[model samples]
Target: MSKWKRLQENSLLLLPSVVLTLALGIYPLLWVLRYMFYDYAGYGNELFIGLDNFRRLMKDTQFWDSVGNTFVFAGGKLLLTIPLSLILAVILNGRLRGRGWLRAIYFMPTVISTAVISVVFYIIFNSYNGMVNQLLLKYHVINAPIDWMGQEHAMLTVILVAVWGAVGNYMLLFLAGLQSIPNDLYESASIDGANATQKFWSITIPMLGPVMQMIVMLAIIASLKGYESIMVMTEGGPIGRTEVMYLYLYKLLFPVSTGSAVDQQIGYGSAVGFATAVIVGIITALYYYLSKKMNKVF
Candidate 1:
């Protein structure tokens, strides 16, 4: 075929993806950008109010608190999830019996619906008559039923659930990285009298650097953006104790409660959404910079 014909065929192949991107991704983004400056709900004429939305956002303590809560939730989830995932990956990668079944058991939650998982957890952790408190009470572990979903424990409960749901995914990623590594390196390290701990730190870690960096970057983004489970479990409730940035934005755009402070403000929601994106972008950029520097050093 002629070069022009070949080019035309390639363009035809690419047309669907290009159209879908414009329709689903680029157009909504442009709409948000335009409406962020205007006062409008999903209906009504959009009134351009300039920077008022952003100014209100700056002074919104509840929104800022949700931002803080997001960092806390993400930090806690990453700290517990990443190390545990790596440990599980290392253990299950060995020549152990039933390792395939074990991997499936851990990975099953990842494939399950987030809303379903959250509902299950909510039932398990219900304060008054939940499975957790019932079991503890029956076993004489506690004299009284502890409220897992209460103000004092809501954040911790959600963090634990997040860790459980996330560990398997990162574990599989780490396992892939582990399998790619040649056995010769481990054999050489053994001959050199390097113990498991020493080898893990010196050889395995260094070899897995690129994969680790990518995994961490992905984990950071996912953790920051995650709020659905929290919403289903807590509805950012117990006085917004578990409210994260996206959850807060959801409320503004679709206020579920009649007493919610901000009612269905699409314009304000857009501003908050923009701010959330910027926050995520900044953290991702910072991680990228540090990873590049670390790559240079090692």
Candidate 2:
């Protein structure tokens, strides 16, 4: 085909995605931008009160608390998930018997629904009559049943669940990175009197640098945006202990049950959404800059 004809055909193929983006992404964003300056409750008249929502957001303690909780949850999940995933990837990448079965088992969770996982975990960790408590009691691990959903331990419970759901996905990524590394490098290192540890540090890690960087970036964004599992498990409470940024924004935009109905705050919710986006964007940009600098060094 002629170059012009090929280009025309490619544009035709891309038309659906372009149209969907404009309709679902661009239009909603514009609508939110417009309403951020108004006081609308998803109905009635929207009164223009420019910057009022932003002003309210500045002093909103609950939302700020949720932001702090998000960092904690994300930090805990990353600290556990990334290292565990890399370790699993390294192990499973080796030529062990039934390694294929092990890989399939580990990756199975990644294909499962997050909501289903959360619900199953909820039942497993229930404060009373849960499998966890039952097992602990059976083994005399605890004197009494601990409330996993209570304020004191709710965040910890949520973090564990988040890590469980996330590790499998990152493991697959790490496995791909591990496999891409040529065996020749390890052989050369072996000839140089390098041990397994030395090979991992010098060859495996450095060889996987590009993939590692991308995986870390993706993990950070996913962790920051994570709220679905938290929502299903904790509903951002016992007293907002497990609340995260997106969940807080969701509560503002939609009605939530917290011993009472939460009135929709569309205008303020839009402002909160914008602020949340800004926070995520800043973190992502900072990481990108640091990664670029690290690339220069190594």
In model 2, what is the error at residue 266, expressed in angstroms? 1.1
Clash counts for the predictions, in order? 0, 0
TM-score against native, each model: 0.97, 0.96
lDDT of 1 by residue, 164-219 (tens): 99999999999999999999999999999999999999988998899999999999
Q: Which regions of candidate 2 deviate over 4 angstroms?
A: 1-4, 256-260
Ten contiguous residues with the weakest lDDT in model 2? 253-262
The superposed Cα distance between candidate 2 and the true structure at residue 130, in angstroms, equals 0.7
Q: Mind giving the per-residue lDDT tens digits that candidate 2 earns over 19-87?
A: 999999999999999999999999999899999998999999999999999999989998999999999
Lowest-sum lDDT 10-residue window in model 1: 254-263
TM-score of 1: 0.97
Q: Candidate 2 clashing pairs? A: none
RMSD of each: 1.4, 1.5
